[model samples]
Target: MPTLLDIEAEARGCVRCPLSEGRTQVVFGVGNPNADLMFVGEAPGQQEDLKGEPFVGRAGKLLDQLVMEEMGLTRDSFYVGNVLKCRPPGNRDPKPEEIESCRPYLEKQIELIDPNVIVTLGNFATKLLLNTTQGITKVRGQTYPYGKATLVPTFHPSAALQGGGGDVISKMRADLVRAKKVLATC
Candidate 1:
């Protein structure tokens, strides 16, 4: 099996789609290589693109806060990454072709990290990982089998930042708590 470093090396120079053209760098996943849990978000934003790390912005901070509060865990304890390693122009949603191009990297990540539980944030990450077209609002609050890991779906932290109100934050917190529960059993 290929290591994360092996996949990242190839991904760093990937030009499989137009996304490669505009990205500042491949915002590869970060955290413990052998974590019990993993978080998969939609894609890198401008800050993440510049930093070459996933979830370093306000959304990330909020995620960190909630995970710390609810799960008693930190980034050092879990793995986190995105569906699209490269950023789309203007922070726009990823196109179908872009998702297809990036899917292998994420799959390889899932294989290498081998986290016991995976919590997919928001629509894109959830749908892609679960291989379902259902929206996050409908699919979240549930868990499913994903390779060797159990998958948990949740609202992205960006939703809370983008005027989703306390209800969204509450839901996200609940999901983190749920992920923690799964980790315990795993």
Candidate 2:
């Protein structure tokens, strides 16, 4: 089997979709490769594109704070990545073709990392991983089997930042707590 670094090396040079054209770099993933927890987000944003790291912006700060508060864990304790390694121009939502092109990379990451819990942040990641048409609001607050891991869906931190209000933040917090509960049982 290919190691995580082997897959990342290939992703860095990928031109599978139009996203590769405008990206500054591939934000493949970060944190412990052998972690029991993993966070899967949508796609890279401007900051993530520039920094070559996932979740390194205002939204990331909120994620760190909440995970620390709710699960008592930090970024080092888990791996975080986006479904699309490359950022879409102007931060637009990734197109269907873009997602399809990147699916193999994300799947390989999941297989190699082999985390016990997979936390999907936002609608795109949740929908794709669950193979469902439902949005995050409908599928969250619950866990399902994903390979050998438990899949937990939650709102993107960006949604909370985008004026989702205290209610969204509260629900996100609850989702994190729910993930923690699953982790404990694992």
Q: How many residue pairs clash (N, CA or C atoms closer than 3 angstroms) in each of the candidate models, in the order given?
A: 0, 0
Show model 1 residue runs off by greater than 4 Å.
none
- What lDDT does the true structure give each of the candidates? 0.94, 0.95
Which segments of model 2 are wrong by more than 4 Å? Answer: none
lDDT of 1 at 88: 92
Candidate 1 RMSD to the real structure = 0.6
User: What tens-digit string does per-residue lDDT give for candidate 2 at 110-182?
Assistant: 9999999999999999999999999999999999999999999999999999999788899999999999999
Q: Global lDDT for candidate 1?
A: 0.94
RMSD of each: 0.6, 0.6
Give the TM-score comparing model 2 with the true structure, all chains together.
0.99
